[model samples]
Target chain A: MAAEPPYLELLESVDSFPHIDISKTPYIEDESSSFYQLLLPNDARCHGYIHPSVVHKLAWTASFQVSHSIPRTVQLLDDSDGKDTAAACSRAFYEVIEKAVDSKIYPFLKTMQWENYRIVGAKYPTVQLLRSAARLFGICSRGAHMTAYVRTNDGIKIWVGRRAAHLFTYPGKLDTTVAGGVRAEESPFECIVHEAAEEASIPADFVRANAKACGAITYVAKSSTAYGDDSSLMTPVILYNYDIELPEHIVPRPQDDEVEDFYLWDLEQVKQAMVNRAFKTNCAAVMMDFFIRHGIITDENEKDYLEILTRLHRKLPVPTSPSEA
Target chain B: MAAEPPYLELLESVDSFPHIDISKTPYIEDESSSFYQLLLPNDARCHGYIHPSVVHKLAWTASFQVSHSIPRTVQLLDDSDGKDTAAACSRAFYEVIEKAVDSKIYPFLKTMQWENYRIVGAKYPTVQLLRSAARLFGICSRGAHMTAYVRTNDGIKIWVGRRAAHLFTYPGKLDTTVAGGVRAEESPFECIVHEAAEEASIPADFVRANAKACGAITYVAKSSTAYGDDSSLMTPVILYNYDIELPEHIVPRPQDDEVEDFYLWDLEQVKQAMVNRAFKTNCAAVMMDFFIRHGIITDENEKDYLEILTRLHRKLPVPTSPSEA
Candidate 1:
């Protein structure tokens, strides 16, 4: 039998995926980088797309396959038809992916061989088709994904896990065990419950409710070797948040095959772990920041965590390194 | 060929079935008396098996079902169990529909039978099943059921209508074209949109945002006919406030089949229409009161209507010649 993976080892491995070079990409980073911020426009007309480097990094880490090569078709709209605005935005977004792929930003990135990504009917980029392969394999739309904060006697412990190596995207990367895409007809609440059961072995009722909202994240990257083509859109993730309080008697058991192990840490411990590079998962870091701001985790420890995040972000690898130029 | 039926004539003749005497039944009343100054409870658990007499008065006047004939074994908490407490609250509400074949209430006022009366599902006593029905009927739930105050060139026209006569209950009585039940799976916003479309034929885009949450009203009644059989519960109504700006060219058109006629009533006209002894609709009176309290209708004519309502409520129906008890 394979030995159980250590928490930090799994987290670091997930974060080590190659990122796209963004040094030359003109983009503005905002203070409110929460998932909800993804919906707000970073500039005029269009919200800023993620740098190709970041997309490449996410694709590398996630192990998503790239399938197609298409020409870049970015169109700047001064003023156009309101009815076609969503479609226009999506077309422009697709063009950015084309550019990223053509640039060959990350040679090692794999392509999403499955035709999972399609234009969301009527709603443009806000909606997408569920890939049959993912559906058959039980990988659902990201809209159904939920982040649950479980409070234990030891403090608040959230269950995060690394994706399996065989998975197409985010392989070996840390992610919420209970987060994934919701199916076409499924409710967000129902989807989260199903995810919790499948990923963390936690009962649906274990989730507590407080503030809830929907958000999205977009990024561009080169196609992976898994794809027959060279150019493809990288990873675009949408996430929803729900706060749940579980009974003390409920114990979490991560799926043995899908997840390597589990850890129960207090908020302070989790914060320290995040700063110490003990929890290197990008999603985990984002969720921790959310928890601290929402008063779910409040203390002097939050100040320290924030400082660490700021410093780490500064030193984090950029898509275009000085050596590359 | 049959001549096209006149709207009012068709509505009046639709539910010509004889009325059932519900007063003798074992039923629960939400309040002690209609004249009593008591507020309806908001909690779903506060329901009681009511006297059929109260059911008849409340349900008929309110234009909804008053039967205690539905199966009782179904659990109310099934949908809510282990989910959020709010989901529990929403799912915990259920009414016992007395199963009486060939009963007057059954054919004329207990089930949704007429297409015009179909506000996307059975429009009897609750928003839950009604909302589900809305989805089944393919109506846009978010734009149909809720009321909107549209600003026309003539001023703000509050659209109102009488329930279709062939409806299971509340036949021929005035009802809001929008406000209705929130489904088990739907939010308040969704319910109103469907209601608006079905009842008033209002287009979806016409509805404005920034809805003022006006709260809710619940009424229960016991069957007087089958005293030991079952009781009726009616929480058929939910209220919301929305404002829409209309272009001058857009003339309000009431769905001839669902509404008796379109009334572009100003504040004074609305007030006068509400208390006109001949108006004879409970829902209209309630809506008028709502508008008045919210200061939507402020004019001398409204004061006259209020005076009329006060006088009408104060005087009980007088027994003539000692023949009536």
Candidate 2:
């Protein structure tokens, strides 16, 4: 057999974070605790993992209305009359932390684009957090990705995107044809349809009619911005994957700065790019899963076929869907 | 929202077995050992698990050529000049054990149909074991299943089969359109193609042209025949799933007694059957996975969408593919 393909390495890179028992981590306002578990007001489940650096600041923020009702648990106290008090309190803390922390030390805090990411877990209602602070709090965020392809005389050709170099994270990396974070209060399908039009210039009507909700790709990876000294965060992501077959006449062009250009590459070209590690880590996984489902990657050709399939769909410790309030 | 649909119960049924620390199980022909780990000749991997009742008999069968090279492990000794000595020795011991033990006490032994199941594990060459004895020794078995559906005027319709009532196992339970054990040396695709012709009477030429190989479903369940006495066993299975869109002109008829009849059911009818527990345990999982991939089961409708998706594709402890040898 040829040397093990680079695909497994890409998967491991995303799943590279060490397994830490959040249950054993400090919950109360214990300064000695290296990590803090995010908890809801009354829910018993751990909502997220917060590093000590952010936890210290969160404990000092009086307006945030945080609580420690249970021993060794950090629950966000929301007694206000607002409908989405959890979101209000969380946004308040993130804003305070952004001003208090050094941008050079915590670069992610400086890239607040106002995109809201909804975090949900267990019995706790959904809370909207700033997208840039999702990784800092070790929250499980949702995204929608779509792979558009066309059947041509040559064979199946996939639409690939190159991220703009000016982007904040994974800049200049290859990405799926259309991908974006599922903003607060947006369903995965609606998010994908919106992203297709904004990122790929595909008409929303065309996407709605053609995009097939294939399933999802999930993984828990250490945030790329982890400074590895005093601060680190776990970033669990669930990307609802979609596949849309476009006609030869419908060409995809970049409509935003998120993507530099689009290329229709054949299977061999896609595999080469994957092996070369040009695609973003999770995007490679989404494409790899697509290949398996489409039969391009089979048990015969890929030795790690089963491993790849299982790894791509790791069960996140946090809840994936929003709680109906 | 809707009483947490019965789908999760079906998944829990197949994955209902408790996890045991197989590493702690005794080996090296220890009479006091409750369970014995099966080791290969000169291979370090734990190939299978043996209940004490079967292990006691295996240790006494000298001609079967078993050894205890390592502490707390039963290694099958294969030093003969003949090819595939492991299979030959295993067959010899199983035959003796069958006659020594009463058939009424172990009913699985009485129904051997001479079907060979190829068991593969880490670093070990594949060994063929009798299909009836696979569960007796806690071996990982391979099977192939295909769901045949057609686009109808009303909606999409699937071809489902009812197992023959006279069958010894899971009799009268509903099953996928085509499913069968993948025998030694047969690829999953080859096995599915063969089963399509033999079980469903679908033309081989048509199946070959239309069937799409769409990954696999894996699970580890306690054998139903496990008397829950001293002779229980774990059964790990991997079923390669295929999707074939048959034209309305073509209809499937039962070609053998394995299936009594085939019915074309709509989406709601299939969901009702799934909820009613009319389908076989693992077959329900296959259909559930199908619905998710086809977009019938979605995050909006199903609260446990991510959990179900991850549970359907479990990572088996044993190797899924055969070693080159």
Off by over 4 Å in 1: A1-153, A162-174, A182-190, A204-237, A276-280, A293-325, B1-325
**Each candidate's DockQ:** 0.01, 0.46
Fnat scores for every prediction: 0.00, 0.51
**How displaced is residue B155 in candidate 2, in Å?**
2.1
Docking class of 1: incorrect
Q: Looking at model 1 chain B, which ten-residue stretch has the lowest summed lDDT?
A: B316-325
Residue B46 in model 2: shift from native, Å? 2.6
Highest-scoring model, DockQ: 2
Candidate 2 structure quality by residue, lDDT tens digits, A149-175: 999898899999999999867889999
Off by over 4 Å in 2: A1-5, A18-35, A52-73, A78-105, A225-232, A321-325, B1-5, B19-35, B51-72, B78-105, B225-232, B321-325
Model 1 shows how many backbone clashes?
85
The prediction achieving the highest lDDT against the true structure is 2
Q: Tens digits of per-residue lDDT for model 2 on B108-133? A: 56665667777755453446667766
lDDT of all predictions: 0.35, 0.74
lDDT of 1 by residue, A216-323 (tens): 221122234443333332332223444444455655577645665555555565555555454324455445434532434322212232222222122111111111
